[model samples]
Target: RKMSALAGRDNDYIFRQLLEYTSFTYTYILADPESKEAILIDPVIEMVNRDIKIIEDMGLNLKYAINTHVHADHVTGTGEIKKKIPSCKSMISKYSNAKADVQLSEGDKIKFGKFELEVRSTPGHTDGCLTYVWHQKNMAFTGDAILIRGCGRTDFQQGNSGRLYDSVHNQIFSLPPNFTLYPAHDYTGQTSTTVEEEKKLNPRLTKTKEEFIKIMKELNLPYPKQIDRAVPANMVCGMFELQDAKK
Candidate 1:
């Protein structure tokens, strides 16, 4: 949805949330209305063309294509988007050990005109997970650290229940209670949640640290079917493997 941002100011920003059905991933496009500069987050490889078309139609200058972490569910579109929009650079966390044009760290700011997203490292689902915060807009893009009513599975990719617990409490929940949180994937139909909602209603996160860890340990979820292919491809930004992946 499109709306005005920054209270008491004459600011108009564009925001669109696109969903990739197969992986249940949410790709976000945020642009500055005045400058027409845009940034895309957590894009899936299969949706590159559609996303690019939207950017083009909107007359936005695609400045950055960013991933919250190295995803295991689907290949990233960052590399492919960069290829089509030569001016757009691919970005990820330096701790992710993934190749990208920009490797971010805590406190790093991704600026597209008057808009900026502050990076906060919140590793739990994976050691490189990052939550991007738009302070002016009072929103946070939470990759997989926290979900609508659940949290990311802490069973693989260096998943640590304790670390994940700390990350959520310290980084995300600490934001203003009114702040909206957008996640990478959601099994349920819900699209977004507020900090206050999760704080009081999240069954898993409401418990003590030790209790949260216990719950994570007993999830007994199945192994990810696509990890074998998705991981290697995602490491290099999902560029060279597109041909083989389609086969």
Candidate 2:
């Protein structure tokens, strides 16, 4: 089931659909209009044009193009977008083990006009995974660390069920009840949930740590179709060498 909601729209954080594959991947355009500043998160290479148009049409400056993690599904357009917007800086967690213009860590706040995004190191989906909290609007962007009504699968690279359990309960769930949660992927029919809602209703979250691990282990999930290719490319600093793609 596919889940979606028009959450960021009302907040003025304009979102444009770059790509939504059968695997259900998505690239987002999250912008702060007050500053005319913008960011592309988990962007798909295929949707590069649509992304560029939004920024060009709005006459906005793309200050950053960030990936929550080295994605293992679709090719990322982080490097591609940088060329179009020369002044735009590309950022990724320092743990990505890939080169980036701005390697960010926890406690680092990215300021945009009246907004400040506080970085929280939430490792579980990936060791270097980080989540952003925009204090100005009480919003949080959970890349694959946590999902809307569900949590990200921890069977992939650096994916540890124990780490995921701790990351959510200790770091994410601890946030105030009213903080809005915006996730990168929406696999279910729900879109954009509150942290409190996730802590209470997320199937994977509403259980004991021990039990959660049990469930994950039992699944014995299969590898993502592109994991072999995506992981290597992603760790290479999100570069799209022409020869390394699936035509």
Candidate 3:
């Protein structure tokens, strides 16, 4: 089923959080209210129709459909979204080796109207993982690099526990303590978390680098069931051909 929520809004931006229940993924929509130009982040293929409706109803000029990385748990909707909004380009990290209209790298900035998202290469969960920071908004869209209280399993897709340890500490934890972090997926029904909260309370991330690596190595997480199909489709920007497969 498709579910969405108006998480918050302010004079600076329009924010909404949409969820694909099956994967517990959260797709975010952020727009410059004044210009009505918007960007969709971490879009899921199954929810494209619902997401498009929201944009049209709000009269938003869809600017970009961006994937923080080449997702392995669910197919991305960037390709489908671009088809619906021809002017909307699809984007992914240049390091992802994925097909997209635009390839982003560290220090690259994505501008939609007056709002911008600064790209930070936070690789660990995957070699191409990215975290998009809206410095002005004091918020970041953290892919699978880190989660609400836990972190992504560094067991596949170029998984590296040591590298992940450094990425979070240097890239994410270094942000302002009050910066709100919106992760790609949340299973506990949590909406968002702040840098301060994660810094002090994140059981997996709060430990020292050595400790973090050790903990990650022992997680023994079950293999993701969708990876075989999800990765291929995501690589092509969600243009998957397996209609018989389920997300």
As for lDDT, the candidate ahead, 1 or 2, is 1
Return the TM-score for each candidate structure. Answer: 0.93, 0.87, 0.93
Q: 209-229, model 1: which lDDT tens digit per residue?
A: 999999999999999988988
lDDT of 3 by residue, 179-218 (tens): 9999999999998999999999999999988899999988
Model 1, residue 45: C-alpha shift (Å): 0.5
Candidate order by decreasing TM-score: 1, 3, 2
- Candidate 2 residues lying further than 4 Å off, grouped into runs, are 1-19, 242-247
The residue-by-residue lDDT of candidate 2 on 1-247, one tens digit each, is 1111222446555555454655466566666665667777777666778888867776667888887777787666777787677788878889777667889888887765455688888888888788888766777888888887677778877888889889888878888889988777787655588988888788887899999899878877777887776777666445666336643
- Candidate 1's error at 98, in angstroms? 0.4
Model 3 quality (TM-score): 0.93
Q: What residue pairs clash in candidate 1, if any at all?
A: none
Stretches off by above 4 angstroms in model 3 are 1-9, 241-247
* TM-score, predicted candidate 1 vs. hidden true structure: 0.93
Model 3 CA lDDT for position 168? 92
If candidate 1 were superposed on the true structure by all CA atoms, what would the RMSD be?
A: 3.7
Best by lDDT: 1
Note the residue pairs that clash in candidate 3.
none
